[model samples]
Target: MAEAARLLAQLIAIPSPSGAEGEILAFLEGWLRARGFPVAAFPVPGHPWPNLVVNPQPRPRLLIDVHVDTVPPQGGAGPVGPVERDGMLYGLGSADAKGGLVAVLLAVEALGAGQLADSPITLALTVDEENRGRGAEALARGCRPEMVVAVEPTGLTIGVAEAGTLELALEVRGRAAHGSVVEGGRNAIREALGLLRDLEALPVMRAEHPRIGQGAVTPLFIQGGERALVIPERCLLHLDLRWLPGIPRDRFLQEIAGVLARYPVAWEIVDLSAPFETPEEAPLVQAMARALETVGLPAIQSGMPSWTDAEPFARFGAQAVVFGPGDLSLAHTPAEHIALAEILQAARVFQHLLEAFARP
Candidate 1:
């Protein structure tokens, strides 16, 4: 636990912004090497940062994956340096992932090489999980584990499912006219807002699920009004939509199409990450539940509110779940931090989970 605290502080001290995770990755590989752990450094195609995949197995029954990148640090949000005070460690990337990442490392160290040699396991420290998820995608293409644990901040609960995210880009066109003209053709921004309101009001957008909850649609970006004295001819709007599992894709599309038919708008849908759910009855989930109980923690089932590396692994038919320490809401915020006790406790949980999988 003391070692975990020390290593987590050291990791937080490092600046590992997305797309520039080389230094952190190097440090981690060296740390593992020093412990007699054989690590495989694989270069991610078309990316500067490379992934460190260790203990590769042929269709391994279990794979533990974590991302090395954190969101770029923001000024005046919180302490960029590590601060351990009153049982909490506050710093950049503390709760969001570095805490969980350190916990995984300690658990693996506890398991050691001897026991892992007989187990079908692969541990991947991937990159770009915050952005494109290309790191996870690359790892999935070659080595598809039957079950995967994509480590993220889930407050140590078993995350059974996650919502799928979609990027909706819209362009509303209108005739340009003088800003002060009484006969102004149309204001693209005004039209875009009305269209957005109607789009957000669709019943499909309100689809709900028990674990992950109701679907959501929010406007993320907008650009319009170029000339100072002219009514804009075009307005661009981007919407972020997160939908839960069981929401019929065809129904959602049909509803949107019906709405679009009444507007002068051009739109496109970019699928970001697919929603995934691991049934509680699955062996993988049962094993994790047993681990929690073994570790003296409640076997609570929950859902991941954000996208993660699990989505990519699930594409290859891997039963995936997100579980770790820290409050996800604190991530990328001024209050970002994690409880020191949770760090050690999560390590124990991971150790138990690994041992459960390693058992013959």
Candidate 2:
């Protein structure tokens, strides 16, 4: 428990905000190597955000994956310098993901110490789950896991499905005119508002998934117009679409096209991630449930509304489950923290699974 707490604290102290996870990657590499695990670093493009691959021998029967990168720290929490209080560890990435990563490593260490090294378990820690899922995407394009368990903060629940993400960049173009002749020119802001109205009227959003339930869309940001003296010529609106499994990317794009055509506007999908789900009764999910139950934690299958890297695995047809410590609510908040008890619980649960699968 101490080791896990220490490791998590050190990791959070490193400031691995998304797009800048190199330092944390190196830290994890050295930490795992010191424990006799072989570490390999996968090169990430455009930034030092490398992914750490920790492999121990005996052929991995289970693959544990976690994201090392976190959402950019809002100014509220200056730096996640570890703080321990009331048996909880508080920091920036504490709940969001660093804690989960710590639990995986600790579990692997425990299994190794018990001479259960024969169990097939590989820890693939990725970068960029907060912004773009490039790290997870890279893994999907490269290796295949027999059973994938994404160790995100699930409060120790067995996660079966996750909502996917789509980022829309809508641009409204209008004829710019001097402020004195504002009435003579079309205002892009007005055009953009019309487009938003159309989007708000979309009934395509289903309220629930078969297992996950209810998808949502939110207009995250908007920007346009340099000065009040002139009629704005352009406005850009960014929409975040949280979709369920049944919605196809093409269909979503079609709907966007249909909405934009009614106005003098152009739009493009700046980023897209498809919704993914695995059946609750899937073999991989069953294995995870069994593992959790063996560790004395009653396992109940659940779903998350937020997006995770697990979607990419589902897209590639890998039966994946999200399981780990920490609460989803604490992920990026100023009060971000993970209960020490949960960390210990998660480590033991993972160790139990390793022992169970090591035999056969």
Runs in model 2 with CA error above 4 Å?
45-49, 56-61, 77-79, 113-117, 177-183, 210-213, 226-230
Badly placed stretches (over 4 Å) of model 1 are none
lDDT of 1 by residue, 1-360 (tens): 578779999999989988989899989989999988898877788889789988876589999999889988887856986999888999989987999999999999999987887888889999998777889989888788999998888889999898888788889998899889837678888899888788778887776788877778788899998757888889998988776777666776678789878888898986556688999898889988998889899988888867898988887899998899999999998779999899998999999989988888
* TM-scores of the models, in the order given: 0.95, 0.89
The collision pairs in model 2 are: 60-120, 60-121, 61-120, 207-214, 208-214, 209-213, 209-214
Clashes of each: 0, 7
Tell me the deviation in Å of residue 161 in model 2.
0.9
lDDT of each: 0.86, 0.78
In Å, residue 231's CA in model 2 sits off its true spot by 3.8
Model 2 per-residue lDDT tens digits across residues 72-179: 777774446589888889889898888888777787887773354445666788888787788878776676666788888888988887877777888889989987
